[model samples]
Target chain A: MSNLKKDSLFAGSVKDAAAGGLVALALFGMMIGMQADVATGLGGQLGINYRWGAVAIAVVIVFAGRLLLNLFVWKSDKPVTRTVGSLLPKASSFSGLGRFATPVFLVLAVVLPFLLTYFLGTRGSRQYLDLAILVTTYVMLGWGLNIVVGLAGLLDLGYVAFYAVGAYSYALLAQYFGFSFWVCLPLAGILAAFWGIILGFPVLRLRGDYLAIVTLAFGEIIRVVLLNWYDFTGGPDGLSNIPRPSFFGLDFERGEGNFADFFGLEYNSIHRIIFLYYVILAMALVTNLVTMRLRKLPIGRAWEALREDEIACRSLGINTTNTKLTAFALGAMFGGFAGSFFATRQGFISPESFTFMESAVILAIVVLGGLGSQIGVVIAAVVMIGGFEFFRGLEEYRMLVFGLLMVVIMVWRPRGLISVRTPSISLSGKAKGISADLVQEGHG
Target chain B: MSNWDNNPVLAIEHLTMRFGGLVAVGDLSFNVGRGDITALIGPNGAGKTTVFNCATGFYKPTEGRIVMNRANGEHYLLERMPDFQISAKAKVARTFQNIRLFGGMTLLENLMVAQHNPLMLASNFTIGGVFGLSGFKSAERKAVDKARYWLDKTGLLDRADGPAADLPYGDQRRLEIARAMCSGPELLCLDEPAAGLNPKESAELNTLLNAIRDEHATSILLIEHDMSVVMEISDHVVVLDYGEKISDGTPEQVKNDPKVIAAYLGVPDDEVDDVEEEVGL
Candidate 1:
């Protein structure tokens, strides 16, 4: 310790910098050393400009940065570094402040648009409202997928297939039968659930990785079928001009009997936006309410039991086959509801909207939130959707930043940001939170 | 004695399980007497687990049927039933050789899950429960009370709120037994319940098993390698060797049987008589 004050921090960093400089040189040589330019315009002669000076400077900077990092961080036992981990709540239970946290967040969510409206005016708040709506959509999707992936421990890579089914069901029903959004909503959920059962039947005996592969294949099949079945699905062009959901048949636009006219207020575009946001919020809350209630019910307990050990569940007299199917169906039904909402919100229908990437993002939210944790999903959804909005300006580097954030989260909390499985019931007349280590992440 | 010749709780009639030309349990027949602890003991790979699997509906025997008779006069063909139905309808609950407690769930939740069938009915498949129906709530309270009873019995009432994974090894073994009891079974099957227990823990297990049999009126069928546990608690013992029953009698009678002693001592086929004679048989 006495000798370190003399040369360890300074001399040790300098010694390591030579190797760091060599690494930086290898990395930045092609990145900063060479540049290609078109001499004139579109078809002009291509020229290669080589400037070794920039590369040398980049190497120097990297070396300098490495040296500074070592001196400040690596060399010191207690380094001065900042982390956002402290800002994140433990979320172990709704023990103390957590009970109020949900209601407080709900109240805030309910008042957010109005708050922005009062401050920035209606038109200015539209962007923020749209972002909130997107966040709510993911929250709804996350809760839906949580029932399958989180509760039942079924790795469903084809969740978007159900979402697409719901969207297409609503679109097709509205187009062909002239059904209203109200009529098609339940129909969409039912159709999606039906497809879920169809998928469930074949994969009854499969679990873990095998279940995931089959589901991935099923998702691709749905997309490819939609791509090829031009007459039925409109192929690559997709169906557009999908009908928007009114305020219970009271149109938001100007007419003989419109929402604004009925309310005696001047027609504002933000009204529909606000209405859609509330609709999504209400739907998300319903998903949460149902999931919360189900947790105490036998069906939900069976799902958790099945997740922990299927053989044990069977031995304990849980009908695992039926339990797994119900998980698939119920999860798909909610996805269907959100998909129909997506259709109405965009006033468009497209197979592209329900890609594997969408499924991955939704699954990633459930996982990153901590499986089986309801509040965790909400936090993950907001951080994912809202954070992406914040990172949109990064453009080319946005994906790099996103990947870095995921890696950081995984490193800090491998289970999740909020990885606590609170017991649905407690013997002490109070809910005790099960710590993350005790909670199974599930094999799937 | 409540033997199968009079009133058997479970009867295995020539049960045979073949896995691709290799017979795991070859034409095994046994009777688990009503309200009696029947021990099925064997050396390693003697198909004790295979028989348990067949009886518990994990495996379908190539031949023979298993009949289970409940005290309420309900008789079931255990072989024809599904895995869950064996426990749910036939009233047969079993613990695995490996402790299979729901690690992520609280001990109470694990026990609660065992009472799923009855609670599922009372909840009306969750439609009534979601609306907070009084009927469902009362049923749930009753279920919780039952779970509490088992947890208290296992001496884990103080730690019921904790996840089952947090339980120590000896506690987990007792928890598995507690979980099985939560199902309200007329017959309980335990595979290697004393496999990894200390002497004190093993003695405690003996007490619990005996209490379950005496007080609860539940018959027990166990596969054990622990002779002390078997001899102390078993009312009847069935000895198996190479997928075949070598001896079957009361523990005292079975212990003195030369064939069972030969099987346990691993005497050669030709030296069975010589070994018996040397032991002063």
Candidate 2:
């Protein structure tokens, strides 16, 4: 028999410790590289305290963690460990995880506000709810973009253009025409979808990188127009005092017929935060539900087919023009919905918020989620947005850690966190999801 | 020939296709008999695919009329319509030389997508589909039934749920044909269906083609390089050389035609007899 455990546990600790120490030192140094010692003319200076101590702790943690991981995981000779090491991750292995992940997430999301309020008190709960709302917004945007990029295989690098259209639509409509958030929401989606078709028609013949470039240009054009056309869009100053969404016309303000007052509860600011969290949670769920339903519909299957092979889709009598247009329009519609929600949430709208970087982030979320995988988008959005928020205190290292985490995840799971895709149609009794590897990359 | 319909299913009148300086197909004319297997054979660069492309509306011929007479007695000027309209309204479905099955989708989805136009109408543009209305549901059920029918006919019912690309090469070819059949095409154009098939698979293809012609009453226009398959299965043959039709007749007549032997053997017309003797055809 082959000697499975020849090396002693402590054989490489010193070398590993030294390597870990060097890495930790470099990381800590990067984390605290440049700082201004702001002294208030008191006895002490306010700056990063004991940068060396932080680095030492980081080194010790890395050394200990690396040693433990190497001893148990890398050196284990158990058959189970060997089997797991030998096994490649597959769509089948992760397929079961998807079945439970959504429900668990939904339940957790539903009870999160109540749980936080009960434990942290109302004043303390606002921050967590705010974070949850931010995460949910990105999740919603990811799902919306998933329709065009993931299911239809269209590479849209200017998705934020639609979000801008939506936000501007709500902002301009409310400012000029005195429309409520409820009325403006659908209008914004309609306007965004209209713009999507307008953008879609001229570029129907373009694919791949060319399509991406054109979409990026279109996004820039919208932003520029919003910036220049001060007369209609308030120019660079942006539109402020945008209306907030209410619960069936009951505002969450501290006046008569306010939500708290109508409900016979004391006027607490946390109610609005909690309410906003649920609103976004509900919108995200609806987006997920509609997308899931569309995945099983004929149009959805047509989108997948179009993605697989446009020539083949044409051969089969599918109207490729209409297919591409619908994907653009629908994806833009959802983006608009999220945009309107954003306008309501911020009570302000600006061209600066809908930048190309926003599009890149949303597109990254879709790709990292695995194209055409719904639940994958949720996980990716949480990881991306939540991680960015979590590392906010590490101002210098925030982007470094975030970028590193993304690179690690991508290297570990090249097909994104969840790569399994449910087939639009199945002939057997049950639907068997296919691996995303079997699918071709989206051309448009 | 017992059930062969005498009417001409597709008529190409003086079809000419040009790519800027090069004429891919020049003055190619032929008639595909209804429910008949017609083969278009040529050497490399003879532009057999260009003819297929023109006939299927993928390319509008530089000059000519492609008149397709459907089973419903509707006549269509195929060149005037877009590529998808040729398949959707003209009821002319085709497969590519490279076997263009939707590799990522289940075999069933590939067929269901072929029925997109009808399903789109049945779903009332997604309003009914979203609500799961019975009208749309029944239409979907029928579409599934049609897909299943074709899958069963192609002997791929067992692999219906798997990705179409996962099937072997020969099966992908059959799946392409089955997917076209799901659209209920009046004429099916196949490009090199027997190119990479084993002898057993080739024989199986023959059975499937004949069944489609005899049972389904679907006319076939195929561009094939395999002489044995063409000679064995095709009821009629058209030969092309240098983008021009050299011969058009029954298989036996085309096989013996001096011009076809000259085209295939790349010999002078007068020396065709000697070339034929050497080629042992």
Candidate 3:
């Protein structure tokens, strides 16, 4: 537009290009340069090949890319950020999007398995069906952790321990007592919730990083106990032949009077897979529904108040201990239900299945999904788990790509995908019709 | 005690609070009359807030008896009770000096959270609420009505939907008082409520606190540095110097007390007459 503006833009672009080029040179040079390569190709046998030429080319490409970005993307950053920053305050204050997001996501999830079956024709869509199941499990886990980390503002790094508790409870009961999957589902949840309360008591006084370390230790302690308690927990070998949930007491086994006969349809393994998908889908929806409802309750508001300021909540006469414990217990309850489903689906689990990495993945889902947002958790689970499943062939680079995507996302939206919050209760629901003039007319 | 009511709603006897090596409050003794506005005035860091914290059970007194007598014929030993019990059981409510309202929550939700104990019981531990039962539904409706009443009283009914943190400093102060009032406490303890308020907001706060005392019949123990607020609304004033009561009487008597003048001016006892004359006491 102006001479000064144009000159500054050019100067800034040059600076950006030079900085990007230097960074590229340093990174590529260390990673690719000065490395030993015994080459058998390019007319060489057991010869060390220097990649300085390739490294230079890469640095040049990076410089060009930065220059291009500076001209287009970076140039637009000011207007874009200005517009976004201006719009976010109004958008985040109160929006209709938060109300409709969950129902829309629920519809999509309900039709996902059917859609995959329709497009890929059931047999070819087995992997997609399994991926959907996996995604829903994480969605449930993310929603569960959303209660503690998002709503209550408690950093629980060992949430997977509750999952382990549920899975193992189901596994042990089914294996020892010959219990059905349905019989052990509630039992698993109860047992996991019991463990949640037990773990909650000692850490009630701890907050922030201290609480995180204690919960992390609790997770690891559970894993170690499961690994060493061989006689009771089946040790590292893990319990097998865990019973699968039947379709209303109808088995999917290949025998007379199986699920197919009961339904008067042809028997196929896809039937069981589809059934499992629906089961977890139902579980995830229930978790979402319960969390949404709880967000409106007194205890739910107490949890949020506690999150905002514990001393203030206590000063207001809220029982901080009960609030924190309820958050932990309820979060663990959902994790437990999901764990039971995980056990029934896999039919086997060991200490390796409930490692610290699992907790990290679930925590990442909640964080990246926008903490306290149910629909955000669903979308994030689909993106992360579905992306991992789809990129199975690129296994070596999957984590790197995933990490880069996460960094990019954090840079783009530090608060996560749906950071805007909608208050659970409002008096504005009535104030909408009343005029401000009338309100001011009566006031002193 | 000649013309004043003898029954005290809160009595702090020899209340001493120590932090390892330093004594924050030492042998402080005071009584807050029923339905009276009692002001606790002192210089900065004179353990004014420490006494409020001890009375509200935020800090346990090292060796003291802090007793609260509720109108319902219940007496609570505040030092022996947990912080929440001091408010919920002993009917004591408090506001923070820093204005610790739930920032992310709406103004209405912030007020509703103050009435958590009763609603929690009515909701049947959330089971009835989740099921949308008639009892819990009515209770929720009542909670909303109560929150709206407070919102209207604080002149925040129009902005009830906005986040509490988005409000300006003065509105936030009013909302904090409104939130504390929603709990319907017998004794309200406020810590520096007029710290950053302008003159107009301060006058408005004075009217509100006077209304609270006359109409709500709630006793108030206020920790304030604003002498205008203290002299305007306080029925009795207790001046503290280094965690000990230096003067306690009606505002006129305490204002003209020589020890209070010495404490306020940081002067020796012999120089109090000259300092009082210099300040036109």
Candidate 4:
């Protein structure tokens, strides 16, 4: 059966390669043709254009070379044997590599700053630090929401409400009580978790669209409260000059006996940026580890069972209400952590920052990455966030391009980028095998 | 007969299920004796399916007292119990007439899901399941072993990892039975088990039912249209006609009854000769 499956997969890959090669060749041809036409039009207008037609010819030659490669490899029956043999080692290697992913990631996290400093010096290190902070923050949010959307299959449109609650909680607590960032972070998480439970209670009976609508309303209500409760939140003006994280008595701001003077290092903003980056990274790793652990737990299995079939889950005597609430609370708690981190990093808190669009983007990251896939979510965040940053120069066209890319991806891979082929772990520690029945019938 | 007064596996007292204006099961009173293969044989829409639903807690009867006696000596008012609780507490497992297996799940998973209640109990209401305790692991192993046992029993062990939907029509029906059996129910309610099966499959089903009755000691309440399956496996048969019980006796007795024949025809006047001709009496 394994050999048969391997054979079939090899055949599929060959077909995919041939199809991809043909599409690439066609695209190359079109690019060349369009470029030549543009050059001729430029020559007509300016009448001083040099012969740049060689570029188009060169592109065509490259396309032909790719076509020949496809014909030589993809068209042969021997390709199946070669593909199967080559893929077997890679598949085995992947299984072996899976065990070391966590350790490898941990090492990279510790080593990344030094690597950046060594290669790009202080100026470039600051930019890398900023990127790391953004990625880690989003990664934390994604892992948190994974509990709600991926595990419990609850569509939460108001997840950012919890984030907002955390941000505001830290901002309010720190300002009023002179609470440090570390002290306020857990308080923020607790507050968000409380709100999550409250939100979960009302939407317990609602599923799918109704749950989404109610959650969306909940988020909007939180935002509205912040807007109207001017006595506390400062209304539309928002909280400003929120106290940043300090190492003991040393602050990030440039002054006598500040962080730089305390540490005997030059006063660069990279100090704070690097600190925030590591903070968020640690938080993200914690979220990921906790979620991964939860997935192996009974509640995790119950969540998956519920997602697959609610009736079956209930019949199993699983208390779905509690299960759902736990998911919401846990996810919301992580979101709160990220929010607190954001507040501390930016030294500001505002309702405008935690808008519906922020929630949509995070949710998109989850979906685009693939539901219930941690690695997929991280990859999705990198692509989406980096893509958005890259297209920042396009201004008005950025959204248009982003929207088009999403539509194209959805069309090609409706299941998301890294669709979960099988469950992560079974309650029964049996050898995992792809059920032919499931393969034929598709997912529930 | 077999000391039903001690405690019937399933007892329906004054069961009347009304679908708006129409009564589907009207004051139907019956007792399914312990370890008996009782067939609820009737023409189409004779409330056999409705009775099955009511017994399985799928529908709340307009008026009824459905007392389900568990193997552990606990009695449950099934009508009052929620669908999940009925399966979990009452231990009254059932298969749908249309074979409602979780098509997307593997055959093994389907069977394992049936043992969900027991596994939950072993895990102390899923707390151990969450923590992956030794108890939970043992329970899970037991559940998997039970699933495998049932799959093997149903001649589906080889196809255990195959999705239930991908199974052939006959195999799918057998898989459904295997799933229900995995629940370890004292009272197994099979609704039209032979509906879409061929003669050979139907015959195999009879053997399977008999084995379940004898070996597992499970009292079965079967709603079947196939005369062969009804006549072969049913120790006792109850005939219904338009929400009313026409006859209730042994399979031979119900088969030869004039009232049962008339009920089948839907006309009282055509009973005499038709009954004689059908039963060759």
- The DockQ values of the predictions, listed in order, are 0.77, 0.69, 0.54, 0.23
Instruction: Choose 1 or 3, whichever is better by lDDT.
Output: 1
Per residue, candidate 1 scores C-alpha lDDT tens digits across B1-281 of: 54754789999999999999888889899899998999999889899999999999999889998999999899999889999999999999999998999998999999999999999999989889888888998998999999999889999999999899999999999999999999999999999999999999999999999999999999999999998899999999999998999988898899878788777878766777777677644
Full-model lDDT for every candidate: 0.89, 0.87, 0.86, 0.77
Clashing pairs in 3: none
For all the candidates, what are their Cα RMSDs to the real structure?
A: 3.3, 5.4, 5.2, 8.5
lDDT score at residue A191, model 3, on the 0-100 scale: 90
Superior by lDDT: candidate 2 or candidate 3? 2
Off by over 4 Å in 4: A1-110, A176-187, A241-268, A424-444, B2-6, B115-132, B267-281
Candidates by DockQ, descending order: 1, 2, 3, 4
Writing each residue's lDDT as its tens digit, candidate 3 over B1-281 gives 53234888998999999999998889988899998999999988899999999889889889999889888888999999999988888989999998888887888889989999999999998889888778887888898898888788878988998888778999999999999999989999999989999999999999999888888889898999888899989998999988889989899999989888877997888888887788666
* Residue-wise C-alpha lDDT for candidate 2, range A22-73, written one tens digit per residue: 8877887667543456656755777643466666777788888777766666
Candidate 3 or 1, higher TM-score: 1
Model 2 over residues B152-215: C-alpha lDDT tens digits? 9999999889988899999999999998988889999999999999999999999999999999
lDDT of 3 at B181: 91
State, as a TM-score between 0 and 1, how close model 3 is to the true structure.
Answer: 0.91
Candidate 4 lDDT over B158-194, as tens digits, reads 7776556678999988987887778777888888899
Native-vs-model 1 lDDT?
0.89
- List, in order, the clash count of every candidate structure: 0, 3, 0, 3
TM-score, candidate 3, first chain? 0.85
Point out where model 3 deviates above 4 Å.
A1-28, A36-49, A65-94, A430-444, B2-5, B267-281
